[model samples]
Target: MPAHIGRPVIRLAAHRVTTDALLDHIAATCRDADDPTKPHPRLGLWKRLIRNTGVEQRYWTRPLQEATAPSSVGHRAGVAFGDALDLAESAARDALDVAGLDPGDVDAIVTSHTTSWTVPGMDVHLIERLGLRPTVTRIGLSTLACVGGAQSLVHALWHTLARPGARVLVVVAETLSTIYHESETTPQSMMYRALFGDSAGAAVVTGLTDETSADLPTGFVALDPLELVMPNSRDRYWGTIDDEGLHFDSTRKAAAAATDAVPYITDWLGKRRPEWAIVHPGGPRIIDDVVTSIGLAEKAGRYSHASLAENGNLGGTAVLDVLARTHDDPPAPGSPGALIAFGPGFTAAGVYGAWI
Candidate 1:
């Protein structure tokens, strides 16, 4: 059975931060008061790198002034988990409402959140808070990073295909602000501060119904999902832990991770150009590389670029935000398109589909 995805909904954190504000905050917090001669050696480099991220603004779970303050990992985890849950609930409710579905209608739930570590994760919390059936199946993803949104939809599609008329709720939430601890001073760590945002995205996926039951608003009918992890790329992007909190780290080679996956993606796409494309807003290079390699027009990546500019990366929620924008300015009905996202494993996840 084909899986039909409804329009996605995204909920951003309370604090809206602009690039200028972010740079200023970094400067104020990372100064060397005692050793004025040093003056934080990396400040100039960090500023230059941040400006190149193509992120004009972003949102955070906490205020800029407090987020950069020194705090323990335990305290960061508690606040991060709480904030992620709040955003996820809002996004899920709005998604269900958009699909004209009640919580009871969901047969399964798929959730992805990597910014915090929680024993009973967002999936279980949502099952109770959203009033979903106790017997509803659940899948939780904790470390897929930017790939979580597309990967969640892929899992939901599998569930719908397995249980033909079943409805699956897909949610991805990230409170990346929790990782903005002042102790992280590396170039890679600083880049993340400028590139990531806190947001939650949700969508409903179900098996395609007969004409009589076609009242559902299917934004797209999903094709089989594709996944790939590049060889020897484990060090390209990964997570780290310390007294402060969780931090995202990457090597210089991370810049080419997206380009490296292009051939595989192109092959999986049957070496043909899709009518529309929903590339992840990992950054400008990731978006531009994929669009150009796949022979898509520069305008085809507008949604991805806009998402990066308006909300930073949104981590796992990046692709969902791009998908929402696609729905807003839809392509010709029945046009073919592709949705793709990249993550920490230097992995790529994608789904080909046609507008409905």
Candidate 2:
């Protein structure tokens, strides 16, 4: 039986920072404030990279001024994880409510979080907070980054396929703002600092049943899922930790990483042209390259662009936010569509499905 996905629910951090505000914050915090007349030696490059990220505004877990303040790793971890959990729980509750399911009705949970590391992680906390069964099956992904949403959905599909009638809760949350510290000054780090935001998203996937089939929400019916890793591409993007906090590092090759994966994805998709596309809003170039390469209409990428402009890159939560927007402007019933996301490890995850 094919698993059915519910419309996703997205929750963002409380603080909204516009591009101008973020630039101001960075100049004040990262550059030498002693002399207002002199910009940091690298300020020009940072501005160029940040301007190209395609983010107009983004939400942060804390005030923009305080987000990049110097702090111990342990303190950062606590704040980021706590805030992310708050968003995650809210998103999860709303997701289940929309699907007409109680917490106890969830047979399994799939979560992806990479912002802050903690023992027992988000799964254990969510099980307690959401009152899910103690014995519920769970998969916690810690390093998938931007691909988390699509990859978690793939796991949900697998669970439902193996355990018919089971319902799997998919949650992806990230406090990427926690990693935006003054210590990270590399070009790639600066770009990431500007590109990321904080958000949590959740969706429900269930195998069709005689009882549940009639109640299934109008959304995607999961078909084939693809997981791909480009050979010799591990260094394109990666994570590192220092005394200050976690940092994302990337080489120049990272810019073309998504474009390089197009052939593999198109092969997996065969000749089917998707009527709709849920492209991860990683950056404008990534979205443009994928949509054009895969033969999707220019409008197919609007949801992704809109998400990026409104919320920045939500890391692991981005794909779900885009999916949520797709739900708002739904396609024709039973039309074929595709969902794809890219992340560190030069990894790509995708699902070919149809509107229901």
Candidate 3:
């Protein structure tokens, strides 16, 4: 826990989505009957209930029906392991290009996303592709859902500091185009089916010593970075495979349970300025309720709206994507911004900063 301070220089970053393909799936398969206004009486109640939540658009790796596992594995995994990494690599390369650095320059790696699985995970494969130093360390996280990217960045920042002149890579890939549940009977299944989307994002966080800081443009400066762990054990949010198909447990209680921790959040944020909060866009009511209790009435809502409109619930990468969009266009070397996210176990990660 370095007493959070200074801005982080982001050397590179990129994002990807299967846009044309995803729009086709939504138009053809989701069905007009799901539209509440154009309900098909014969199509039954649930089938005709439309979700025109203004996300008239979203990207996916492939159509839902096409995202399937091999014959031996049986059924669709939504987005398979290899496909997800393929996208992740594309994103990583793009970021590296922006940074004007090669893979060998990277000293550490942090990979995020909870919607899909990789055996050795994305970090291992990326390390091989980029020819990173053999000593490069890796951090692989799961179950953080949309908040994971910022969390991963925080992890990278810590490692980079321990060894001066080190550059850490943060990669987030989510094919929520995959968190599927064959059985659409339960509220949980229906909620996820209509919400999750696929997308990948990556960035490089490089260290800036006094000499280096003078030569670089100041980027989003970091405030205090904090991670709160829940003492009580609970598996409220997770994914599964069952008779109902590849189901999600975006359990009904996730938000309510998260609300129970509001007191802790306010006191925590009080250490700095809650007026500059960058809250995750969990959903409409989720953000609203959380902010209401935490007293971030004016500040906590900026990222939530943008996150929903641009990419939907990106699972683990939402925070990073929104930060890129919200920070000043030509951010000075010394600008300040706050970063925060929430996830399963009701844990939270927060960081504050200034540009360069």
Candidate 4:
């Protein structure tokens, strides 16, 4: 009946790059190169998706090619890997500062991103740059999509459970607009915008003397991990890069698959009797499907809708954004809450955690 779990502690919370700046840059640079009569590439989008995506704004690491790492926007897409590194590192540092913990204190580092990959990835790079302990563990997630945070937390929990007093750092960097392909308007492409935005989130989670998250120090939020291995008949979500930048695929069947999950989530929630629902604000439809299916339309719906309206879908950062919003000031210790998220691989992950 108690939801307290995980090596609970949110030592610090940090973010970098204003979402508005990224969105504005995206709008200014969206060139419709294929617009026939107009001969203007900026006018090509079939509809004004920037507004429709419900993204208040997003973050970007300069024009992928235009920033530090030289890039040929016409031939190759996005800023050079080095440029992305700069942004990611800065965000991570901000998190460290807020945490009031030195890089030396972190025993592990976890990073999540969808737009770009690094030769060493952000985790190793951060460890080297921040001068963390040589033996620090690093977990990098690129496949989980919107569920990246939950997945990373699951791994963090395991790491902490195995060892005590060890701290873990989480960094989620999303530069969605960088992958925009100007040449496409397929349904898949259109729908993706409704679920992506550029942003970064970082926090510290660690092991302590206590068993439950409610015992975490001030400024920490915790949730339980309800690991779900939902393998479907086929790929429910996927992404690709082409002349149009990056395109995402979310089949109608995926939306339909939502129906199949209701029973499972219903049984899961019924057992816990969650007080607050931190469902991934994946978008209007994903939120609707889950809540309606589980019959938490009124309770979880409030937080899900709030996250969607305020920040669009921030890939790995979506669930954390929800957690950040729902946290109380005089934080109620042991208050029950549910964390649920879905992503590619037709995967579903949920956790139950109580506030400290």
Q: What is the TM-score of each candidate against the true structure?
A: 0.97, 0.97, 0.78, 0.77
On lDDT, the stronger of 1 and 4 is 1
Candidate 4's displacement at residue 250, Å, is 2.5
Q: Could you give me the TM-score of model 2 versus the true structure?
A: 0.97
Question: What tens digits encode model 1's per-residue C-alpha lDDT throughout 184-292?
Answer: 7888888998999999999998877674146756488897788888788898889988888998888888999999989889999995568999999998999999998
| Residue-wise C-alpha lDDT for candidate 4, range 1-356, written one tens digit per residue | 12222221221112233445444444455444565334334333523544555556433444433331323444334343454455567766766776667888888887876665456676777778778888888787775667787777767766776666567787766655555553444656644643455566666776655453333445434444566757553467776655434557767677666556667677776676655566787766767777666546565667667767665677777777666666543225666666788777766777666666
What is the lDDT for 37 in model 2? 74
Which parts of model 2 are misplaced by more than 4 Å?
A: 32-37
Native-referenced Cα lDDT, model 4: 0.60
- After TM-score superposition, the amount by which residue 346's alpha carbon in candidate 4 deviates from its true location, in angstroms, is 1.0
> Which regions of candidate 4 are displaced past 4 Å?
1-35, 38-53, 56-59, 62-84, 210-215, 218-223, 243-245, 257-259, 295-299, 328-332
Deviation (Å) of 37 in candidate 4: 4.0
* lDDT (Cα atoms) of all candidates against the true structure: 0.90, 0.91, 0.59, 0.60
Cα deviation of 341 in candidate 3 (Å)?
1.1
Question: Alpha-carbon error at 272 in model 2, in Å?
Answer: 2.3
